[model samples]
Target: MSLRVGVIGGGQLARMMVPAAVNLGIDLRVLAEAEGSPAQLAATAVGDYRDLATVLEFAKTVDVITFDHEHVPEEILRELVSAGHSVHPGPDALRFAQDKLAMRRRLSELGVPVPDWAEVRSEDELAAFLEDHDGHAVLKTARGGYDGKGVRLIRDVGESTDWFRILDEDGRGGSLLVEELVDFRRELAQLVARRPSGETRLWPVVETVQRHGVCSEVFAPAPGTTSRLVDLAASIAVTIAESLDVTGVLAVELFETTDDRLLVNELAMRPHNSGHWSIEGSVTSQFEQHLRAVLDLPLGDTATRAPWTVMVNVLGGPSAGDLTDAYPKALADQPNVKVHNYGKEPRPGRKIGHVTATGDELDEAAFEARSVAALLGSDISIAP
Candidate 1:
């Protein structure tokens, strides 16, 4: 019998995993809230990821369960584990991704480099944090925030009061975590995969560009960054995965401080936006590696296939028409570019797909990727 894998959340991640599952001969299924979700195209089932009954029922047919997002409730995950259902990146490891405060505290305990942070329950607490951090700080909800949502920059105590009230009134507020905003040179990401057997692999660190909290582009090896820095970031990713007992793929987002230090910024237990470049750049794409790790199979090679590669996210723009029209134009312009569309309905600011280009030179590949992305309507210029 073929090993069956059930995935929670039928987003683009799960959609991309389908090809990997096919390549590995594993039966892939997804639990989604509705029909026609990205992953539902290949999933064995479509249902609510948060509904225990749906999830449990879905789990019964799969050998192991994994996730596309961290939004699944911890209680439900624990219940699934307790019931003898194998869940990779289990609840213990997932909690850190689900709650920023929990992640910050644990990273601190592990002696990982991270910004100074504190949990705040009220404006008074926010004020104390701000005073200590130089009157400016980032405030984030402990849970459920993503892609620029649930995050605020407070310049003073008054803003903190407004934030506290606004978040509380929204009924989605959880504990708040405030941190000193670092003057970072750039953001980087380290991608790693771990198996239940304790085997692990790390990919080359990449630089990420974010616009409005959404990752817009990624450049592998992060121009001008030394091999030493890449090794350091990879080590940090492996350490966090081992410490958290995480199985499957994990992404550690980092901030390269002005003083030349790397600080942990965020964690994702599933295949992350940062690793999307691996699809065309690495011998083993993060999606494939994730499935391998979860199934306890031997991990694949993570070495880059080329000296440099670039991935650009295609965010829906204001053109308000079918973006597919640009595809033929893009392919005509750059035939070597690999484009992956999520099959999602276009909406302003939503991620619809990504384009990746690989070449011997970093700048050339980045230009190709950026040119394709610009055809999709991004204002960012491709640096030649």
Candidate 2:
């Protein structure tokens, strides 16, 4: 019998999973909030994921429930689980992805390498942390922060006073975390997948470039990285998945310091932006691996298919014309480049699609990926 999988959140991640599900002969369905959502083009239901009635209805038609985002409420997830619906990366495991403070506390207890952080409940606590950490720090909301929102870099104690006041006035003062600003050499991401049976697999560590808290590009097997560093990242990813009892994919974003140490920066329980290059770079794409894991099928190979693979995100810019107009030019110039658009309406700084290119030489692949992204109106520089 073909396995049925129901995914929550109707975004590009779910859109990408469709092809993988089709290839694996799995029946894929999406729970979307509205018509024309990226995944709605193929989803089986249209409703709010937070509504228990809606979720239960969708779950009734599928053998397993998964996610494209971690925004779904834990209570709703618990309800589904109680009803005997199989949810991969279950509610217990997803809480860490939804709340940063909880995740940091748990990882610290697990002996994972993480930045020094403290939960600040008032201006006094914020001041103390800043004083101890060189008078500069990064503050973030414990929940609902992404793409640079709900995050602030405070270089002055006076500036942070207003931020603390705003949170306190809104009764959300307790949902905040402050951490020292570490000067890191670069950002890295380790992607791994776990099966319900406890089997696990890992992909090569990739370098991620972020612009204003949003991912701009990714490089597989991060250039000039040593085998030792790769092993370190893979070990951390595997250990976290096993410790969390995660049943699907998990991405551990890391910070590589000048001292060659790795520090966990963030956790994502589903296919992440950092893993987008795997669609064409790895022997088995992350989307495919996620489907296999959720369905309790045997996992696939995680080897890289080329020496270098690059993925460039296409952020919407101020272009009046339809973005598709650039496709003809991009394909004519670089036929080998693979483009995946999320079918979203263009908005300033929004992620619309991405382009991937692979080659024996890193420079060539990076050039191809950037060229296509530029044609789509992204303003990022491609490194040679």
Candidate 3:
């Protein structure tokens, strides 16, 4: 019998893993919150992830458990471990991904290159942080924030009073994470995977383009990356995975500073968007690698299959309905391009899927991916 892997949360991440699990002879089961969630096609149970009893019952059926998102409460994860379930990137390491304050504190302790940050629940505390830095800063909710939801930029701390009020109204000071706004030259992502038996590997550092806090595109081996920068990025990811005892995949999102340095921006201990190019670009895709890592299987090579690979997200547009209608046109236009639709309803600005392309030249790879992604979403022409 194949090892059964149970995934918590039913976003596109879990949906994408189905095929990879099937190929590896792993039985993938999903616990989704909704009947029509992206991973519903592979769902074995549908219930609230926050409910302890619901998750525990599902955990009993699977040999191992992993996450599609980091929103699972720490208590639920810890309870699973207490009950003897195998959870990759277990509660101890997952806490850093779940809470920005905890992440910042822990990375700081480890001397990890992270932007100077602090925890603040009130405007006065935020003002103090702003005063320490220039007059501007980025404020984020320490918990329940992603894809721009619960993030903000403020020159004056007073601008955040309403959030403070809401937090106070919630019966106590709510979680708030504040950080100095770095004058970053660009954003970079480094992906690494580790197993419980201590095997680890790193993927090439990649450049990430963000639109309104969401990832828009990814370029493998980040164009113009110096050997020094590449080494530094890889080392940081490796160190974090080892130090945190993180199992499965760990994505280190960093800021390439204007002053020529790296400051960690965030961490995601799972298959990440920046590594999406691996599906068609690398010797081993992250989904397959994640399964291997969690199962204590020998790790695969992280080498790129092509000289260059580009991935562009397909955003839902005003004209978007069902993307199936556009698939024929996109595929016919660029058969060399690889398109992955998340099987989600089209809502404006939503990330429904992505398109990837690989080639000998960076320009050609980027052009193919972008053009197909544009066709799949809005008709915005991307100039090479």
Candidate 4:
């Protein structure tokens, strides 16, 4: 009998996992949030993941459950477990990703290097943290924030007037997280997968380029990363997976500080955007690896197929139109490029899809990845 896997939340991530599920002969199913979500191609159920009854009904069918996004309420997840269901990266591990405050506290307790941070509930608490950090800080809501939302900069008490407004009205204390702005050299991501039996494997540490807090491109085996740094990243990822008892993939997003040190930035307990490159770049894609881990199957090799691989996101621009228009040019201009469009309509600043290229040299791979991505997003054109 084939293993049955059910994913909660139908987004691009779940959509991307379909091919992997097919290849492995696993039954893949999705619970979509709407009638025509991106993952509708694989969805068998459509409803709010937060609705306990809906989730319970869906969970009853699959042998194991995973996630596309992490917003499923903790109460619902806990209920699933108590009812004899298997949820990889189970509630305890997932809680860390669901709540920033809980994550920071646990990482600190584990002695993991992280930015100076504090949980602030009121304006005065934020004020004190900012004062200690030279009147500069990044404030974040403890939950329901991603892709640069739910985050704000506070340079002074006056700058935090809106949050202070919330505090004054609702007495929101201990609901916000404030941290000293990191002075990092660049962003890095370490992708690791763990099976329920305790075996784990890692993908090469990659350098990620972000524009206004959104990931723009990724370069595998980050150029100029020393061996020591790579080892450190590996250790950190492995330690966190073990500490949290995380099953399935865990992406440890980090900051390589200007002074040559590493600090834990964030964590994702499922297949993440950072590992998207592995689809065309490695022997085993993160999507397939995630399925294996959750089912306690042995992992596949993570070795890169090429010396270098570059992945670029196909972000939407002002011109929201059918992306197929870009396909002819993208295919003709860069035949070697691999493009995966998420069946999402174009909208400004939205992640519609991504393109990747692999070659012997990093520069050429990066150039083609970017050029193809631009062509697909209407950022660049191939004129006759």
Local distance difference test, each candidate? 0.88, 0.89, 0.90, 0.89
Angstrom error at residue 64, model 3 = 0.7
Model 1: runs farther than 4 Å from truth? 166-174, 379-384
**Residue lDDT tens for model 2, 1-384:** 778999998999999999998887888999988899999766889989879999999999999999999999999999999999999989999999999999999999999999999988877788899999989999988888888887899977677676677777898446579988878999999999999998899999999999978999899979989999989999999989999888889999999998899999999999999999999999999999999998888999999999999999988842776568777887788899998888887787899899999999998998988988887777553453
* lDDT, residue 227, model 2: 92
Error of 2 at 153 (Å): 0.9
lDDT tens digits by residue: candidate 4, 1-384: 889999999999999989999999999999999988888988999998989999999999899999999999999999999999999979999999999999999999999899999987677888889889988999987787888887887797677677667756775443688989999999999999999999999999999887767788888978898999999999999999999999999999999999999999889999988899999999999999999999999999999999998988887832746888778888899899998888888887789888889999998888888888877773331111
Weakest 10 consecutive residues, lDDT, candidate 2? 375-384
Candidate 4: lDDT of 203? 98
Over the stretch 116-186, how does candidate 1's per-residue lDDT look in tens digits? 89988888888888889889999888888888887888897786676678668878655589989989999
Give the Cα RMSD of candidate 3: 1.5
Tell me the deviation in Å of residue 5 in model 2: 0.5
Clashes of 3: 0
**Distance (Å) between predicted and true CA of 125, model 4?**
1.8
Worst 10-residue lDDT window, candidate 4: 375-384
> lDDT of candidate 3 vs native?
0.90
- The worst-scoring run of ten residues by lDDT in candidate 1 lies at 375-384
The TM-score, computed over Cα atoms with residue i paired to residue i, of candidate 3 is 0.97
